[model samples]
Target: MEEDIQISFLNKLSCFFLIVLFLGCDTPGKILIKNETQDDVIYRYYKKETDENVAIDTVSIHVPALSEKYIILGFGSLWTESQLKSYIQNLQKIELIKATDTIVLKDKVEIYNYFKKRIKGVHKDEIEIIIK
Candidate 1:
């Protein structure tokens, strides 16, 4: 009986680890933004606010030069519109700023883009944005 219990415990532990490893591979829905510049760049991801109209939620994250940043959404493409978070289903935007200068540059930002027009009933698991 003792040996059987120990074996059962080991099997459960092994199954748990395998489940975690599989789930940790990547986000179901993710936006990959790449910074092709030679210097680091700061960017923002815009999501509409859920509770208030005309309100917004902005995520400011930076990527090392020649690297990429991933914006993981709460729900994946397989999720229906009703199942997705309100902010994520709305229009998604990204603002790219050139950060080579030292003066906390604000006005010199180069371009603005509409990352996703609108996440409709059907979407993709991955979207990639390349910024120059």
Candidate 2:
């Protein structure tokens, strides 16, 4: 009877471990680039590979006026904590290369509201930049 009880407990523990490993601790840090400008703004992100502010003229992430571009960084289970931290740190050194000037919004109450079912973030971690 004791052997059966131990086996059942072990099975339940294994199942719980699997669930936590796959679901609970696996979330990537996300960034949203909001273009509150008059015209369409074209911007790009780069990591400080060697601590040089090389002007990356490549026109990447495009956000229309009053729209947003969501970028996802760091893989959940694939990346270690240190690696994710390094990526975020490197982003800080990158310069904001924008085609147009930013127009600060007065009422940003719904700034973070997004349609999760329809919209998705670009999963290019190294190139994805910006937090606020």
Candidate 3:
């Protein structure tokens, strides 16, 4: 009876470890922004927390027409994974400005879904912004 109980406990422990490993592998570690447009674009992103807009930073990349550029969103080290996820979900707004025209992308289901999908899997999540 003692040996049986020991084996059962070992089996459960192994299973738990396997589950943790699988989940950790699937969690996304980075955010990728791809610019798919015909002109150079400037992207500005802000974090929306409790109805306040906190400016993160601005990125300027010369993504040529029909090309893609990758931008990594790096949060500070003080933030936990849950905090990062919440901040990503609450991304207030993104502005894509080219020349004199400005385009705005809001935080909605589509955007959330996009980020959620990117947050999973073995690769960084990518958001493709297209200007038409």
Candidate 4:
């Protein structure tokens, strides 16, 4: 009877651990940048923290004329999901610098809504920037 009780307790503990593992498997929010352009583009990603715009990463990739690339940006533990989404939506400047030309994308209401929707799910958010 005591052996049976010990086995039952171990089973319960295993179940609990499995549940925790499944719950923790939820993917964090991310940013995906797809470059569909003729020339090689240099992209910079930034986040606003403590009232300052901090550059997170910079990548220069030669995306073919029709192909796409994904850039994943994860959220920090310091802020909630909503706060992180808001910060990304409110970003005033996102630049695609190519050669001597620089294109600036401003965050309008529609743009913010688009980003909010993209980053809403557990999947990574995606944005396609086309350079002419």
Candidate 5:
């Protein structure tokens, strides 16, 4: 009878530990998306990678009722137009470059997830990639 009781206690302890373990961890394949809704809100991140005070060209793309995309290209910062064009074209040809989503929370915890993209980053001449 004592042995059976001890076994039961051990099983209960094991189950409790397991419950605690699973509860304290984040499940894989789960990502958070945050939507920004406001006028004149700077939701995009642009890095010049240089200390030049040059004018940068930004392109914001929004499908009327569908999706949104933002691209910031700095003029005379580092990359030439041809280099940027080639890089953009190569990015478009990639197969797994899916949607880019951002998560914004209270207290300013923000992160960006590039979904379905096998390559996290690539190096190009005269330009540095920024992931936020």
Candidate 6:
């Protein structure tokens, strides 16, 4: 009985380690590199606030080498429409930039990216979107 119990415990330990290793291989985010000939830099910014649980907003920017040109901007989940609209408008007004491209907004539970000239401030609770 003692030997059987020890074998069972060892099996569970090995399975747990394998599960962790598998998960560590994949991360949560939307960023990919293309055109290896060019030296481009990718950046990710995260801002968070919490009431009870933590809420986070992430921004990803890809700057091309030897130029002021950027290719991509990503917005992770937790960013609402009101927040995005306000952020875009503020960037246009303050930074003197406009949206030269469009981002596809889809209803999926995966990490999402929305390109922008800049990201602005957060939205107030009064402008919340009701899902009901």
- Winning model by lDDT: 1
Please report, in order, the local distance difference test score of every candidate based on alpha carbons: 0.59, 0.48, 0.57, 0.55, 0.34, 0.38
TM-score versus the correct structure, for each prediction: 0.49, 0.39, 0.43, 0.45, 0.23, 0.25
Task: Please report the candidate that would top TM-score against the real structure.
Answer: 1
Global fold similarity of model 3 (TM-score): 0.43
RMSD of candidates 1 onward, in order: 8.1, 10.2, 8.2, 6.1, 16.8, 13.6
Q: In terms of TM-score, how similar is model 5 to the real structure?
A: 0.23
| lDDT tens per residue, model 2, 1-132 | 999999999999999999997864566655557766666665554444453667533336777767778666545522333544444444422234455344221222221121122233343222233323
In candidate 5, position 118 carries an lDDT of 18
Better of 1 and 2 by lDDT: 1
> What would the per-residue lDDT of candidate 6 be over residues 28-81, giving only the tens digit for each residue?
322222323235444444444444375555555555543343322333322355
As for TM-score, the candidate ahead, 2 or 4, is 4
- Candidate 6 regions with alpha-carbon error over 4 angstroms: 30-132
Q: In model 1, where is the ten-residue run with the lowest total lDDT?
A: 104-113
Worst 10 residues of 5 by lDDT: 104-113
Per-residue lDDT of 114 in model 6: 39
User: Residue 78 of model 5: what lDDT?
Assistant: 24
Which 10-residue span in candidate 2 carries the lowest summed lDDT? 106-115
Per-residue CA lDDT of candidate 1, range 57-124, in tens? 77788888999987776644433333333433543564667764322212212111133432322344
Counting clashing residue pairs in each candidate, in order, gives 0, 0, 0, 0, 0, 1
lDDT order of candidates, top first: 1, 3, 4, 2, 6, 5
- After the best TM-score superposition of candidate 4, give how far the Cα of residue 98 lies from its true spot, in angstroms: 4.1
All candidates in order of TM-score, best leading: 1, 4, 3, 2, 6, 5
